[model samples]
Target chain A: MNPLRIAPTDETPTVNFIPDEGKFEISGNSYPENSTKFYSPVLDWLRRFCAEAKNQKITLDFNFDYFNTSSAKYILEILRILQDCQKNGNECLVRWHYLEEDTDMQEAGEDYRDSIDLNFEFVVREDTL
Target chain B: MTDKQLLYAYNGEMSNPVLNKILSTIQTKLSALGEKRNVVKNVNTILIECCQNLIYHAKDKDTLKEDFFPSVSIYKDAGGYRISTRNVVAGEDAQKLEAYLAKLNAFSPEELKNFYKERLTDGKISAKGGGGLGLLNMIRASKDGKLVYRFDPVNEQYLMFTLSFLM
Candidate 1:
């Protein structure tokens, strides 16, 4: 399947999902007015990828500076989907990145790591944009 | 400027574009306040959550009075910054929110963290993608791990819901 790329807006994040290379990423702030509408297609792509992707190893990267509560729910949903993919015998790893000084984002990643059973790595980058 | 003065306040209809404008305006004001980067970010996050809560959950817009229109404000306090929002909600929704806030206020910081984790994967996403995590996130974001709220009954059908976070 072809890759999916969504440009980020003031209230949304940029989503880059590449099924061919098994590289998926979501970055930037996400606090859309209608989060369900914004995330429906991304969730659909993940479902399709999990069902049809032939890649044996998948790495999903999440680098979010800030997201509202509704977006947080969808982020958890995406992680849950990847967890299911891992459970179905696919090698999957999630690189959760945050600014070194942003403890809130780091703790958010930790919260997801604690909730989902998957290979998760927390990467702290510099606080530069 | 007074230390505990009101920094920003808006009392009117809050749409998506208006929310964005409010956020940017507040961000600029906060920058001018010369707060630390982390402090500014924390305040910004809390403001976004509170404003979005008003935007998404506010009901009976057509019947809103001038004083009861959806509103949000930021204040500088002795401890830290406080963000507050007020909107109209149905009586049923107000009851649910009051109960939820009571439950959240009962938890310690660590317990709230656990509760947030549990609710994240509860698979009960609402049509608006709420999944019942907004209040918990607010409480966790608050410096005191507490969300202050009040419900003023307007009539048999609707009530005023006010939520505030100190961060």
Candidate 2:
């Protein structure tokens, strides 16, 4: 399958899902007017990728500066899909990035980590990006 | 008089474009204030969630009643920034929101975190795809982990809902 690359907007995130490399990254702010509409296709792509790439190792990175609650729900949905992939015998690792001083984002990462059973790493950087 | 300065306020339509404009304007204002990066980010996140609640849940969009105007205001207090939003909601929604806020306010910080995780795992997403996380996010981002709210009845069918968050 082809990689899914979406440019970032003022109210959305940049999505780069590389099937060949088995690396996926979503970064930037995400608070789309209609989050479900914006995230449906991305979720569909993940579903397809997980189904087709059996036994492949997947690394997913979520680096968000800020995202609203609706975006948070969709993000959980995406992580759950990846968790299922891991449960299906594929290797999956998730790296959640946040600013070093932004404890809210860090706590958000911890929340997701607590909710989802996967190999999750919390990466903190100084820069907001 | 209080030292709180009203940095920005908007009273008009709560459409997507208007919300975006409000967000950018507030972002610029926060940048000019020279606050810490984390402070600015927290204020921005809280402001976005507050305005979005108005956009998605405010009633009488088509009628555009004068009394039903959705409004948002940001004030810089000695402690920090205070963001507030007022919008008209259906009577039922007002009641539901009041109960939810009461329950949320009752939780301690640790309990709130635990509740947030529980909701994330079990909460049902509405038809509009809102999994009822906005209020929780606001509380989580607030300095006191509390949201000050008021509900005033406008009429039999509508109520004015006000929410304030200090960041």
Which residue pairs in model 2 clash with each other?
A: none
Which TM-score values does chain B get in all models? 0.90, 0.91
> What's the TM-score, to 2 decimals, of chain B in model 2?
0.91
TM-score of chain A of each: 0.95, 0.96
lDDT of 2 by residue, A1-129 (tens): 999999998888999999988899999989886888889999999999988888889999999988988888889999999999988889999999988898889988888888889899988877723
- Residues B1-167, model 2: lDDT tens digits: 56999999999877667877887787788888887778778887887788787777866555467778999999998878888999888887777889999999999999988887877777366666566788888898789989999989888888788899887
List model 1 lDDT by residue over A93-118, tens digit each.
99999877788888889888888899
Score residue A107 of candidate 1 by CA lDDT.
85
Give the alpha carbon lDDT tens digit for every residue of B83-123 in model 1: 88888888887778788889899999889877877777776
Q: What residue runs in model 2 are displaced by over 4 Å at the alpha carbon?
A: none
